[model samples]
Target chain A: MQPQTAPSPQFSLRPPMEAREKFNRLTTWVIVAALLIWSWRGSEMNPMTLFRDAGNIGTLLGDFFPPNFMDWRLYVKEMLVTLQVAIWGTVLAVICAVPLGILSAENMVPWYINQPVRRLMDAARAINEMVFAMLFVVAVGLGPFAGVLALWVHTTGTLAKLFSEAVEAIEVSPVEGVRSTGASYVEEVVYGVLPQVFPLWISYSLYRFEANVRSATVVGMVGAGGIGMVLWELIRSFDFQRTCAVMAIIVLVVTLFDLISQKLRKMVI
Target chain B: MIHVTNLNKSFSGVKALSDINLHIERGEMVALIGSSGSGKSTLMRHICGLTAGDRESGQIMVNGCLIQEQGRINRDIRELRTHIGVIFQQFNLVGRLSVARNVCLGALSRTPFLKGLFGNFAKEDLELTCKALERVGIADKAWQRTSTLSGGQQQRAAIARALVQRAEVMLADEPIASLDPESARVVMSTLQELNRTDGITVVVTLHQVDYAIQYCPRTVALKKGHIVYDGPTANLTRAMLKTLYGSESDDLFGRKEEAPTIVQGAAA
Candidate 1:
């Protein structure tokens, strides 16, 4: 071992930054500041509006005071239907995502397969759940089933992307180990790939389920059937009290499902 | 028995292995010794059909079955692999699965498709896994997650996997490269025992010449993608090694005295 030495006078506490690096850092900050300003103008952001329209907002909110629970039974029933839609949607998505995710992973499949499958997932994810619900409502003629289909398609896209990433990040040696046993391709995936990615997949599925419940509520606004339809009607008819009551129900149900799914996710991971 | 004729492998334009020919008889314990980047691991991988040779080079036959020929693996390579077990240096058992389940995976090719998909091995296969683990002295760790075990234990589990495979040939690629001296002795002795008792043909690659001399009866040496020596281990000498490996002979002749001693007859 080399002998220990005291600090030399030539050594500095911090290294000096090069001119090129300093210039690049300054340029990045300038670009980011310019982009933020441009977006602020494009988005028409106005913090002053809240103070300017305070009276109007107060009057509108006051109209919702003392929420009416006369339609509480209907609100609860439709909320239950929303939960059902989320359940079926999440279950179907989880099933389809397993295969689709494997197909889309670059390490799992060849480029020819992964490229096309990834494009398909991109198409599914590009459109929002509301748009999918609108299209499905036209095809299926407005029902909870349509909402289920919409959430299923969109959630499958999201979950497949997440699942493929997990699969891609796995240690390749375990899969190679399985292959060395003379196991077939599918068997290798089952024994090697799935075991490594199982926990992350479960966590992603639970997270998607929570997000799907929120989407399910809004799908009803497109006549796909849930609490959102009643809420939409009450807003259109200016029944603020009933609308407030319905929003509270939606909040309570979403929170309850989110907590339950969080617990499940924690248990698995 | 295993045979390789004029096998060549190249990554891009640079040759990793070149025009190699070798044959191992049944129940032989042979060691492949080379310095790093000497194509020892690549040759071992080629023998098992895990890696393909150059398109125009040669063919490999393991247990009278064609593993690969001219860069094309046999269509029935998976079935052929069932009879030829391979162990890697990293002990690549699935980390999340139980040790027993990882070992039972050796029976996948024989199990029904649906059964294998669900990881439902036959009762006899499960029993074989138990026996294999017992033979390797890790039966008590059967139900534990594989990642929870020590490196030596994990490596033994891999050996158990090969036992369950009922392989006629066992190829180990630097099985002890990552192990400490004591664990390395245990692993080498285990391979020696299997070759002795079960009559399994064993081929192991090693960078340390001391271990090769102590455990293997036959030694094959590679240098710069070419076979430098293939002979009985007893004929190898310090002068011969210096001539073959030059300055790198020091690495080949590792410090043997620093390695731990084995208890008499414990490995047997």
Candidate 2:
């Protein structure tokens, strides 16, 4: 240019944010900070108490040292039972979740059907697994079967929610391509939707299995069955040494499963 | 044969297509040409009963079977649609499935529900799938996951799927819109070859008039939802297109000079 000119108006490196957007963003941060502060007080959080009670915790921890392994055989046996309960529970939940998940997916069914099915799933999820274990113990008269039933219902609710979300996020064009072939609805689902969601479904199911294994050990606290009942009895009688031994077993088993399932999930996904 | 009458469509109060009537005989390759927002794809979707027209709109019939009327698709549309194959701008193949399985899915209508559900096709259906894949020139790709294929290859796979359906009429809605020039030519020629040899009724919507002039014997031009021209491709002159599309006609010619050479080369 003959004269030094200002930069052209046509190009902008970045568009300036509107005042309203800036205001909204600031408001959002303020609300989040306010909520966090309010919850901190409401929940009675006191970080100073940790240092104040260090001696009491040390004495309590000392009681758990040199864990007693006298009932190692019983502990191992019950741990196997816990694994079995988790296996059956996860298997049944996966089966039930398949149909329930499809029924609850907004893209798969109408609002009337999905709404009611979602509400039912919500009710199932709203109750804790421990609560369900107590109810099932009463109904089934206490055993591994009661633990299995509790995990099945609770896991079905969780897996169905996960499965439906995967279904909803799928691209609709593939399903339309299937529909154009004059494939029936069930055939379209089996061929189109199922293929797209299969990997994610398997991944979610394996993840739920990991969670269920952790839960299975605790269901026995309500007399549902397995190592948790033994754990509960030891804790109640202040048998801290044996309690430590049982806790160690539970931790080992859960960690091993988590690792195996993570590898499997990675392969599938 | 496909027949559409009084096909009116409106999206929320704005007219997309209005008062249209068309009849396409079997074994004819017709090109539907229009600029974007000209309702060509919308009209094609209506023909196959993929979309419902206005409640006051008239009937659409495919092969003398009622497809849709007064905004309601026929109760037996699933059976009726078996003979109508539709190709989209996006290939729309299931990415995780093998190409062979995707083609076999075309026979799902004839297979038993439970068998199809379990992905167990009949022996004849499998043979048909193989033959269809071979015909489309991608039989080697049959074992590959569909998502691994290139754009042109995936489109060919979609055509193979349609072939396995034994479709009597193929409706391609902007089938080549998203393709490169080479892929576009390949897909158009494949469609042309099918029309000539199989005697299948073909209706393809195209944006570039060069392709229409080269591939289709007859042309139907739509502007603002009205069929401004319906005649032999030889008769649609530049002036006629200019009058119909006004300043936007340049888009139809596909940037002027290139269109003439392609059309002239096809004519020669």
Candidate 3:
């Protein structure tokens, strides 16, 4: 009898070489070469400059230590104003964004309506908060009022976009179910869409609130009131120590707001 | 009672429903069965006034009210819908809301906006919701978020919402298509029980033939936007199914031979 050899080991039908491997290698080298060239040409960033400026940088940083707590009352008042600005802006934006967001959602509004509304929101969001603050200050002639107006416009644009996308992504079955019950369009939105997105809306509003607190400081640069105005004054006077103190206070306030907002978001969403 | 005559619908130049006529009697359980694109859903949508078709050609009268005639829908279509309840395959319960809240939403048409905003549902409305939930055997889970429930429980909650609507007519669109075998049986039985006990007119769309046989006594089968069969479920034969679905009959009914014995009591 002829000896039977063991069946040959099974071999995979995979191609001997993968095209992706070659493509990845080529792209990796190209990316590294481009980044090296770009970094070298963009700025005359040499270690020598840092070495020369080390003493000045060190002194500027050192001034930040021993933050002046002498003006605690003034700092606290400015902090309260900043908090108020953020709260007012958030509340106003949230209220305005609901209707605008509904109008912008393709699933809720017809294309003719949603198209124009989305374009308006896009235009509103395209400009930065600082530009809006500058324009508001120029129009209203400076103050926390200008800051509030700027924050309102900026937050409305951002929140509208986020809220509309959330609304659009909601399941359609509930809407249809509500419609079948003979509910009006407004009632359908109130019961069907609102329940699904309320948590997400609250979460997004809190997140925007945290961001607005930080932006409220910079709005002061355009003559809008906040701790930023004092920091700007100190910087202009070359009072690095006082500038450091204000910065410390701003950082502390912002960090505390962030923690609160995060906790609230977790609780709701 | 609902009357539909010569209903026609088209989408993107393709006819989805054509010259359809149907009459649904009060307290009758009617099942609409069809292949994927057979116009059952389209016809059901028309009954709910969710879709507009060639109203000039079709006449739809609900409870002596003319809903559609001469290509025009009645302005009171919204009011008509308040008397009809609809359930969906997706359960359609708001995932973030509590089961009780979702059930309470059924009373939104009657509840004032301020009352709804403050969640101040009337005592009777709350009692009705609890009764509806109890009917579906899920009253214990009323306060839980709808998303936390199993698929069967969610569908039950959806049914409870419909029940709380106090609808005289209920339309279920593929209500059990997304459920497992046990859940599907439970949901179908719940609907059957409602129809038998409460005398609510039920018109359900179903993809499974066995379900139509087991629960619904009357079945209307549609094929290619046309009614191929309309008769008692007991009269359905294998040969009729072959004629209705053609070569697809083997795929649809072959599993019938291997079906696990359904525990009737478990469904209840």
Top TM-score hit: 1
Candidate 3 chain A: worst-modelled 10 consecutive residues by lDDT: A1-10
Candidate 2: lDDT of A145? 94
TM-score of each candidate's B chain against the true B chain: 0.94, 0.94, 0.92
Candidate 2 residue runs with Cα over 4 Å from true position = A1-42, A46-48, B255-268
Assess candidate 3 and give its TM-score to the true structure: 0.86
| Ranking according to TM-score, highest score first | 1, 2, 3
Deviation (Å) of A137 in candidate 1 = 1.1
What TM-score does structure 2 among the candidates reach? 0.93
Q: Which portions of model 1 show Cα errors greater than 4 Å?
A: A1-15, B256-268
lDDT of 1 at B135: 92
Cα lDDT tens digits for candidate 3, A1-269? 33344334664565355889889989999999999989987986687878899999898889777767778788778878877878888889999999999999999989999999999999888888889989998899877888888899989999999999999889888877777766678888987899888989999999999999999988887788777677778788887777777888899999999999999999997
Model 1 C-alpha lDDT per residue in residues A1-269, reported as the tens digit of each score: 33344456686786678999899999999999999999999999999999999999999999998899998999999999999999999999999999999999999999999999999999998999999999999999988999999999999999999999999999989998899888999999999999999999999999999999999999999999998888889999999999999999889989998999999999999
**Ranking according to lDDT, highest score first:** 1, 2, 3
Q: What is the TM-score of chain A in candidate 3?
A: 0.87
Candidates 1 and 2 compared: the better one by TM-score is: 1
lDDT, candidate 1, B149-171, per-residue tens: 98888999999999999998999
- Judge candidate 3 at residue A80 and give its lDDT: 81
Evaluate model 1 with DockQ and give the value. Answer: 0.71
Q: Candidate 1 vs candidate 2: which has greater DockQ?
A: 2
